[model samples]
Target: MKKKIISLFIILTCLFSSFPFILAAQNLKLVSNYALEDPRNLFYLDNNVYVADGTNGLKIVNVGDPNNPQDQGSYSVSGVCFDVFVAGDYAYLANGITGLQILDVSNPLLIDEMGSVVDSNYAWGVYVVDDYAYMADSDDGLEIIDVSDRENPVEVAESSSGGYAEDVFVLDGYAYLAEKSQGMRIVNVTTPTSPTSLGVFNDGSDIYGVFVEGDYAYLAAHGSGLIVVDISDKNSPSKVTNIAFDGMAREIFVENKIAYVAARSEGLILVNCTDLDTDLTVMAKLDDNSETGSGDAGVYVADNYAYVVDQEKNSLQVIDLTASGGGNIWLWILIPAILAVVVLIVRKSTAKKEPSRKEKLSDEEVEEESNEDGEESAVVGIEESESEKEEIELKSIPEEAEDSQEKSEESEQSE
Candidate 1:
């Protein structure tokens, strides 16, 4: 019985400790949404979100209060804004035909362009590092710019990829570009002046977005879904695996080993990418656009919230990524754990106690019976001793009588 209680306690501890995270996977809820016009991509920083609102240019929303997001500022550019990246007090935008445009967003409400440069090709996506900005210039491939002087930004060099460049993610001196028909192109950007193509992985999928973390590059492969590539060997990157879904995978954002995808018709999908070799499981999904028929086009995750851009709806949806039931789930786990502890304690207390009252009474009864038998034996011995004394006395009296008789006969003879 004690062993069973201990085993139950061990089981409950393990189960309760992991219960919250398991439930958290399916607890993504749509909290609030803010209106926008053709919002394309977004970047989260501090407590604000900078969005590339198509023809509306750059729009900044303060998400400090996720339940009630307010528009903080807006910037209207001459060209369509497809992507925006925020660094320090300035905003870098990939303004289609207008090319690379830098804005002084120190004052979100009154954002003003500090510099502007038009590339020979269209700027589809932009990534900023240090004093440089890497642009994915459609057919123009990769365009490197020097932004050391925000007032006079200049294109340092350009590398023409074989296919259309849709998105770019730079890490460890390599730029991983997602080319529409060419899969992914790995470029050695150690020297920004002249970046040469190191290798390419072409799976014939329409790759739209790329995000590199650690040693792998995650690609948003349109109809094919999310594709993982092993880039440990920069020159020869290989495909690790691909997770397929129904809708088009437009964009991807990864944080803390989880990939948040902007799946067009499928809404927002979260994939667990902690273990690439064995577990590429879809942990949760949110498809609340059934009525609108529009799908999610862009996603950015930070502080347990997902900010998604709904294409047709033209709105930014704020999703609460925290597990449901609030703080009550802890109570559920605590109840079971507390019960297991009670069982263990009760079993231990029982083991240290004496025998039952009935058993103790029976022992007392047997001892009383043995004491009565000893008293009876002592009484019988006393009675026998008295009877023997009386018999001896009677024998002595008879002997005296015989002696007296003999003495009287002797006297008579002498007379």
Candidate 2:
């Protein structure tokens, strides 16, 4: 019964999954592209985009023109970096081996690592609040530090929360941690020395990345897709919805009403995040095309242009939003048009003999099955007849042996 149900489910899924690969069509305009590295994170401040180029350290690009972003300078660090988040003039980098490295990007050409927490056990992400820096270290957990003096930072507290924390986002006096596998953890950091875990929302999916705005938590869940949760009610958190980008979401950043998503190799995706009820509508997509450009890592919007870090190509791809109306989708028209064509095709196909190909068996096949069943029955009957004959022969042989034994005993007594 279980096998039958599973088979039926698989068949139904296959039959219903014949729909066309529906993708929102958008008119894209290429702005510029520059050489970089496996740039995983991008921090946009005004026209400057500070990208964390994994092993290549950090890159500072002037994207004022959008179309022609020039790499002003780059700061080399000791370890590979995962992301770069800028609070003020200082950029907090989540360096993998070297822990968290704080740099002063005020002077682009002369960037300096103000201070760092060398004792951290593999920092995966970082966030800054006022004079404190929150490092999401895997083994060290959430390594809290005092960054009051940029030149010298100090570690204060660490919260492992029984999970591996990756990213940290500060809101008000609370910190929303992107705890990989364990989900999102909301911690109270009012007292930087003693940060407390207020609430936790396990997304069930592998929570790799996360972004926050106001009272909402947007998580880049690996297999389960992009998860959006309502963080207004801290204790009793409720999930709003999730937009499955149909790919692995590596990074997510939101500015105003637009959301920039770097979906690994799938490329950069722009969507409207204001409306969570809908599948964060896709605005535009950037991929490896001869006419267009491609990128991943951290995505940010500044001065109407989108800055995407192409991790593999080690390039900075600039996209023009003005040409795409800030990515306003018209799928309403396109979906209907595609549906109309499908309907017309169905009607034409139905006009013909659309017998589901299940009744094409010939009479010879039925006869063959019947013959096979007869052969099995004959084999079973022959085996049963052999067993009855053996039983009868055993009964006769036993009685004859007993009589012969008695006769032998009587003859010996007479002699």
Candidate 3:
């Protein structure tokens, strides 16, 4: 009985402990899906979504109705579209190998190339601020372009850190570069004509994407997972902490204190970064099986839904964030109910095995049975005593017979 009670306690504890994981699993709900061809990157603007479709050029999807996203149109480019950034009425494209391509996207169905600057280095990423576009030119470092003249974009400033710049993000007056093997390099772009390196934080990890919010820079460091660095002092950036994931951290999108991460094969990983002073924790996770494709390459969160780009399936997955009731509440109610049922079943089984009160002997009957047992024991004791007395008499008779024989022998000898 004691062992059974211990087992029940252990089972209940485990069930309760699993509630958090169950809640996390059900948090993300797939609302809808839109298919594209080899979608590599995504960016959300107003009610439109721009996708960098390899070979297919830029594909636009109007998501005004999130539940039913409609394909607006597409424009073909000469090179493979790698990344995109939309500002005002124009869309900037990082055309791999072909260099930077600009397009006027005022009309979703009629996007036209405004201008482009051809460079020897492959343009992997781009970030636009004011009249300038900071391009992550692979091996060539940062190339700043002036887009004020939309018809004729020109390279106003260019600087090289001697590292492979994979992605770039401009904030305040600085350009944050995710340099492949060099970790993060901060460049002072207040003076775009002569961009100079302010500082660098090297962890020797391959950084693929970077996003800065407040004083911390969240880096999607490929195999090393998500690395958080304090960049309040640009000249001396320090590591805050790192949150490791099972798959490669490809890209990250922050909204409402939540870090929406595109974890390649692992899918979308939601992390809570409300407080960076402490270790970052995974709030929830959505895998490929969750109505998304196997290869999660990019993520963009706007309004109440998260738009995920899957390179493997070449599709865009929209996940609902406003849906409710899929939390630990149900688990809380279920655990106790299950425990109660188990307890009742165990009690019922115990009750059936226990003897009924009516079946038990009355006090008088018990006394009568005890008296009979005592009488039987007394009788057995008397029989044992009688057997011993008989044996003693038989022994005495043998001794007397031996004594008579000895007396007769002595008389014969004397005669």
Candidate 4:
């Protein structure tokens, strides 16, 4: 009975626990592609893919129709543009050594530079929240800029991370910095002008990109794959878990707890991070075998389509995530329910077969069983007694024969 209770409890727990994955499960497939020159990283906004085409500059592609993407515009810059962040009417570019370049993108056809801020080191990544722009300046660490005035963006403050800051993500007044070899650094950026370090989580993995949502920060830890960090407690952030793959995880984008990874060597890999308590699940993978690209460098997911930029193939590949079916919430629920019912029925059948000791027996039935047991014992005792009597009689007969022989010998001697 105890064992049955335990098994039922375990089954129920598993059924309830799987709800998160069932609700968030999805698969991906390559739907379309757009050619480019040395594309590195990309950002998706309002159905448009803004790609940082490495020395070729920023190329904008509209992916309103995932099946067929079209080039919308192009803006060339002096240095190698590594990253881009579009906000409102402007687009911010993290142009390597050339520093930050802000562009007025109100008109997609005619893009023009609105402002610029030079960086001492390479500007690897950029993130904009409100009026401030946060940059991951390679060797120089985290650089903050005031972009309230797009025409004249000013240098506000700077925070030095111990290693090369490759990417930065801001969420709930904190800046999560992904430093190449130094792991991750959490900073309190509530005061943009006076940023302070809260904590650091390093497991010796090289972090290339970071994306924070809610209380967790997802990192593209290059060869280490996708690592999830617990940022719920800012003062002491910790590494929660990680999912490894063959490719070099370059950039990561999370939408609705699904992490889309641009695994350079392995192409695009999608992970189901809905249930953090369990091992991260790989929902789908689109390798480099297709026209999508050879070495995927960047990825951005929006409206069921994943936009991946291939640095080697120098093209943008649009993947349809809904082509492969997702786990129907109703189906998931029904499966567990059916299993539970089957388990109950089997248990009930087994219980019926094995009568419980607690069940009361009728007085007449009990008396009849007791009489039958007594009769069996009596028969066994009578058989044993008969065998012992037979052995005694046989021994007595041998003694009598010997006495008769002695009497015959005595009579013969007397004669």
Candidate 5:
């Protein structure tokens, strides 16, 4: 009985331990592509794709059919558009030196400029939440704009303490800024007009983009690759780990423990960050040679496709991420193991109740049966011992197979 219980516990442990690896090895394939000019950044809403086409302004593409993306319309802006954020009926753009440009994108074909807040500092990124728009103005820190009035956008507050803010991501009531050469800065934006600094984390790397999910902030550090920071304590953010890449890391989009990175020379690189407590590992990479560009500017994942902007290719390439691979193998292994454990537990419980029925016998009858039924008792005990031995052997099969696989992988890497 003790041996059987130990075997069951081992099987359950192995079944639960494979979850992270099961989610890490996802298979991805190129679905389709749409040609455009100098596409810098992109955002997907409903079924439409709004791209920040450099010098060409905003380009809208209908992705209702990902296999054949159609160009719906485009609106030209004054400055070189870098980033875009769509909210309700308006599309807010970070228009370089032109500052923040609000457009009425309710009608895709005729996207008219609703308002503009021209500033001296160049705008690199924009994030809109509620009635306010946060702009990461280069060398000028963060700028808060009031978009309550679409036609007349106003700048209510500005913070220039964190030098050269390149990107901003807001969550809850705090705004996270990717400060160039300054790492990251957290600002409390509960009051839109008078934002206060909560904390700053400088790891001596140039941060180009920032994405906040849960209690962690994933930063794209130019030459430093990807840096994960623990923001659970807003007052004191600390670096967790830094994953280096072959090329410069410009932007990142994370979904389901997978990070889609826009690496300059490497194109779209997929990373497995399922275990963030340790170093991040590169699972797959779609290099520039796979496409046409040396510069992969932005990435956005939705449904099961990763939308990437290839600057030199002048197009948007959609990569399919729904293909089955190693995850299926883990699923197949786990299901049967779980069912087997459940069956063993039921059998063990049933066997324990079977002995209770014999308790009704008188003491003299029990003694007589013990002497007369000695052979039957011995047979039952032998059967149980055989069952436990079989279960223990079954528990060792997966452990041995796992060891063999690890050895094979190590040998291949060494060679």
Candidate 6:
């Protein structure tokens, strides 16, 4: 009994001493990181971070400062990209058109486009698990790529077999695909050279993005909404629960109990993915400066600031998640401010949803001529006098009109 007591005392002392180290690791705060241009997606590779800057190419920033980060410059890439993922020393770009590209980002200061494999079409998202790359190739479907050889990425398999595969997540030798129509699919990549479909969970709507953590997968379903799935059984993945959103969801990021989502025009929406039976609580949402379509883009949070990519604004909007107010006055003003912002956003979108022909037309448009009879009819709907009514034909004429006329005649001839 004496010996057992001594052993227990020693073990307890060691455990108690180690508590500080665990607390230090968990006490991480948002380091120095800021936002930049149409930043579409992000992937943290070691100390260096890479971003897909929509039409502006790929931006690599040195996040040596968790707060004030340094810009590592960008590599010129064609097409409007959506997402990026980094593994090993290479950064994989979902180039939208050129498919999945492998860049030599081994040196954070200097990045070179080593090479790339263009998917049958544009690939939206990419995930490298083991040595294989699973790409959510738009239209062409889910493309299986082998990135074992950085210089040469070969396509092993693909299946347009699912809806629009928008995003992909790979782990434990399996790839979880966010298939727009078919929901999510589990493809086993144990055999890196050749991956085979193991199971699929149809979220019953267009799933735009997915993230797998532990035994479950969180998805951002565009129409039907967000879904959680149990992936313990690879052969039969089951839907654990689903939380519907009032707006279109474009992407999702799961960090512990919190699920961050980019809900298009609705801006950056935060959801609590911890409880399946309860409605997702919107922790916070950063409003985009420009009101864009519901398909605008996505958002990412690092440090304590929310970094959002507003495609319509063509810029990255940064929001601080800090309680700097130090008082409850912020909470009181927040609701009304957010409501006002929402109302203004809705009004602006409504104004843009249907612009008058004059507003849509260009400056070069011809000043219409009055056709007395048609004008009389057109205005008659407004109960106007026949003489006051007028009709007009709007058409532009240029010095190269003859050439345009010839092209129109040729098209008519072909018809």
* Highest-scoring model, lDDT: 1
Off by over 4 Å in 6: 1-38, 46-48, 63-69, 289-296, 325-415
> Candidate 5 on 1-415: residue-level lDDT in tens?
7787787677667666765444433445666789888788999898888999989999999888888899988998889999999998899999999999999999998778889999999999999999999999988899999999989999999887848998999999999998989889999999999998888889899898888889899898888888899999988999988788777788888877667889877788877676787778777777756332267889898876778888878889887564442343123224445678678775884476445646988899888888879989889999999999999999999999999999999999999
TM-score of each: 0.76, 0.68, 0.72, 0.74, 0.73, 0.64
Clashing pairs in 4: none
Clashing pairs in 1: none
Give candidate 6's whole-model lDDT. 0.69
Q: Which ranges in model 1 have alpha carbons more than 4 Å from their true place? A: 1-7, 10-21, 290-294, 325-415
Residue range 339-413, candidate 4, lDDT tens digits: 778578557645745555434667787788789989999999999999999999999999999999999999999
- Candidate 2 wrong stretches, greater than 4 Å: 1-25, 278-280, 289-295, 324-415
Best by TM-score: 1
Task: Give the runs in model 5 whose Cα sits over 4 Å from its true position.
Answer: 1-27, 290-293, 324-415
- Candidate 6 residue-wise lDDT, 1-415, digit = tens: 5564566556556545544443333222232335566767777655456778877778877655545667777887877667888877788889888788888887767888877897557788888776777888877666888787878888988755646777888888887888777778787777755667777888468888888889998888776567888999998999887777666788887775667777777766666565666666555555553454543366565654555555666554444554341222123223445457555644544453467776765665523423555677777856654333432111223536878989999999999
- Over 117-192, each residue of candidate 1 has an lDDT whose tens digit, in order, gives 8876789999999999999999999999999999999899888856899899998788989998888999999999
**Which rank order by lDDT, best down to worst?**
1, 3, 4, 5, 2, 6
Clashing pairs in 2: 36-314, 37-314
lDDT of 5 at 38: 75
Error of 6 at 349 (Å): 56
TM-score result, candidate 6: 0.64
Candidate 5 total steric clashes? 0
Candidate 3: list runs displaced more than 4 Å. 1-26, 289-294, 325-415
